[model samples]
Target: MRSNAARNALSGCLGFALIVLAGFNAAPARAQDQLKVAIGQINNWENQAPTLGQDAGIFKRHNLVLENV
Candidate 1:
């Protein structure tokens, strides 16, 4: 029927859209993308994790740049 054809066409369009969205979501980040984290009014063990993780090379290994402020 015409309604069945229309439904199939719509389903195909939706499937293509989902594939395009998945491709966009899977795109990799650039190497120079740095994350800036602000620690206001307090600088202690709790606030020092980002810097510590950066120093430990964990962030670099995961392609993340942590900028603590």
Candidate 2:
């Protein structure tokens, strides 16, 4: 059997998670939304896909705003 402290901690965590989820669910929705992202490449070879994706406007189509670091 679990100790009382352990059980209390677990229940507290579960309750906090539930409240956070409910808060998100109660928030208003936006019609147009974009998420900012930064893409970094280790070398020239790794940079090809994002470059091509930017040229192809694939990220814009998916409502993602990518940035380089």
Candidate 3:
């Protein structure tokens, strides 16, 4: 039981790390200087953050072209 708990904890930590790394790898805006992002809908917070960020000039500050289609 103790070994199983340790393995589970290790896996959980690794999974969290994987997600963080993936997020970093997914957004390489500086390398391109421009990006075309497409969202299916903007009816929720998940779809709203980017729009708000763009409206707030955050994406332009970072030299990105985040568009919702």
Candidate 4:
């Protein structure tokens, strides 16, 4: 029927739109992307893990730049 054709056309358009939107967000980050970590304002050893790891060059070995905030 004509209504079935119309429905199929709408669904095809919607599916195409979803695929395009997904493609936009599916791109991987470039190598060594700086990642911002939210460490609480607590100035304790537990909260300094990211900073310590960064200083020790642990994240650098894994191609990650940690920015603790």
| Top candidate when judged by lDDT against the true structure | 4
Residue-level lDDT of model 3, residues 1-69, one tens digit each, is 479889999999999999998988895545526666777566877878877898999878777777566
Clashing residue pair totals per candidate (backbone < 3 A): 0, 0, 0, 0
The regions of model 1 sitting more than 4 angstroms off are: 1-32
Model 2 stretches astray by more than 4 angstroms: 27-69
State residue 53's C-alpha deviation in candidate 4, in Å. Answer: 0.2
TM-score of each: 0.47, 0.39, 0.45, 0.50
Candidate 4, residue 14: CA error in Å?
54
Give model 2's TM-score versus the native structure.
0.39
Weakest 10 consecutive residues, lDDT, candidate 2? 29-38
For residues 20-45, what per-residue lDDT tens digits would candidate 1 score against the true structure?
Answer: 99998996756656899997554578
Candidate with the greatest TM-score versus the true structure? 4
Clashing pairs in 4: none
Once fitted onto the true fold, the runs of candidate 3 whose alpha carbons sit more than 4 angstroms away are 1-32
Q: List model 4 lDDT by residue over 1-69, tens digit each.
A: 479889999999999999999999996867787899998875787888898888899999899998766
Q: After superposition, how far is residue 46 of candidate 1 from its true place, in Å?
A: 1.0
When summed lDDT is taken over every stretch of 10 residues in candidate 3, the lowest stretch is 27-36
Could you tell which candidate, 2 or 3, scores higher by lDDT? Answer: 3
> Stretches of candidate 4 above 4 Å error?
1-30
